[model samples]
Target: MKSRWLVNLALLLVVAGIVAFLYLKPQEHEETDAVHEVSNLKLADFDRVSIEFPAKAPVVFEKKDGFWYLVQPYAARADQVTVQRIVSIVAAQSHEKLPADDPARFGLDNPRLKIKLNNEEFVFGLYNPVTSEQYVAYKDAVYLLSGLYSETASTQLLEMLDKNPLKPGEEIAGFDFSRLEQWQEVRLQLDKGEDGKWQVSVQNAKPSQDDINEWFDGYWTKIRALSVEPYTPDRRAGYPTFSLKLKDGKQVHFEKLQESPQLILGRPDEGMRYTFPADIGFTMLNPPVGLGK
Candidate 1:
């Protein structure tokens, strides 16, 4: 009788262990199952992005040498933050996924916005009134994603432009004031000497080291334009040219497009036009002069 009782107790303990394991096993799956991926691609995997809206021009961006550039609607440097924000859609997560059969129910039949990351296309549909999450269609599946993704891609093309005329990481080595009228009759050429001191071609134009450094570091290097537009030069018009030499042995040329209400400088090679307030523009075009600050 005692032997029979021991067998029954052992069977009860074994059953409890199996029950506990079964209960804990589903919890592990629940943790992983809760996260549903909308796209398998990461943000870095995308080399190009195309955004389209209803009744408007489509904007396109391409990554080159680890830097993003606006390739369509005109070529110019891209705002890195904005481009990264738009690219983040590929990393979005979905809480629910539905069949693409009833696309009209989710407004996928006539998507409000369409964005393409490389060859993968994502179409934005109507928002869920309860959650405010947007429905996006990719491949044969429809996913509910954050509305921020759609809002980011629906921006004006101008907002996508980098306000700075110069590319990131470009080091200025010198300035060529030969095209623009310099002090007196002397056209100035300024370059960084081997010892890292700024050297001017003409002796009479020597300014204090502090003043020169301030203009180069505190001003020109930190220059930000009020706005930018696609540059289209008129063949009949004469444009004054200015140039900036980079430490990388590349020279960037700029054409003075306007000088009135607002000063406009056009980078012909980049097809970009940078506009600045008259006072600021004057400061950028003219360097500091004299020995005292």
Candidate 2:
């Protein structure tokens, strides 16, 4: 009888161990599933997106270049800071639930801005679904409000000024002198005329020496503060180009393709070759003229 009891006890212990193992296995699986769900969330995947503004234009950003460019009307560079701000705002709120009805309150009226997802594009219009209010789209979201046009004018003006300068000689080509105070004081000399020719003379052209310098300094300070850090190209795109905006709101644009980058400035065409400083901004205006044809 005692031997029979021992066998029965061993069987009960084995059954209890199996039941415990089965119960703990599911809890481990549940914990693993929770971690996996959180890991799958990502925001950078939507980094490259497009935004459109009504009565204005459309802008596209490519992840490879990490720069924003205007898409519609014409292909042009977009404001870097503006693109960054929009991306940041959108990515932060990706997981939030969007509200229905008066979505314009969130800046969705007019539905001007469109965002491109992996395989889909979302459009947000500017308009008051119930009332007649203007709307603006930013990032991947929208907002309903007025005063959109006021900001648009200033924004477009800055974009135009950035691309073209107001230098005296060039017609379509120009530099915006809105920022001119950042450069250190450099000497300027003009040669005296010999009978019908000119001569060279150096004058005290310090920042304190002329009112023009003071005005220019102030203008440059403002521009530098607002302007984005200039981008450096990996390789030489073409001949080196130089643009200088004078204190008088005049611009001088020059280009030379010789082995060295040189620029000639001033009227009667003074031969001045500026060795571009790394800090000073540089940009390419056109393709190479004569080399390796």
The lDDT leader among the candidates is 1
Q: List the candidate 2 regions with Cα displacement exceeding 4 Å.
A: 1-47, 52-58, 61-67, 92-113, 117-120, 125-216, 224-293
What lDDT tens digits, residue by residue, belong to model 2 across residues 31-68?
43121111232446554655555665554554445545
What clash count does candidate 1 reach? 0
Q: 282 in model 1: Cα distance from truth in Å? A: 1.8
Off by over 4 Å in 1: 1-33, 54-57, 182-184, 291-293
> Please, what is the whole-model Cα lDDT of each candidate in the order they appear?
0.84, 0.38
Lowest summed lDDT window (length 10), candidate 1: 26-35
Clashing pairs in 1: none
Query: Local error of candidate 1 at 105, Å?
Result: 1.5
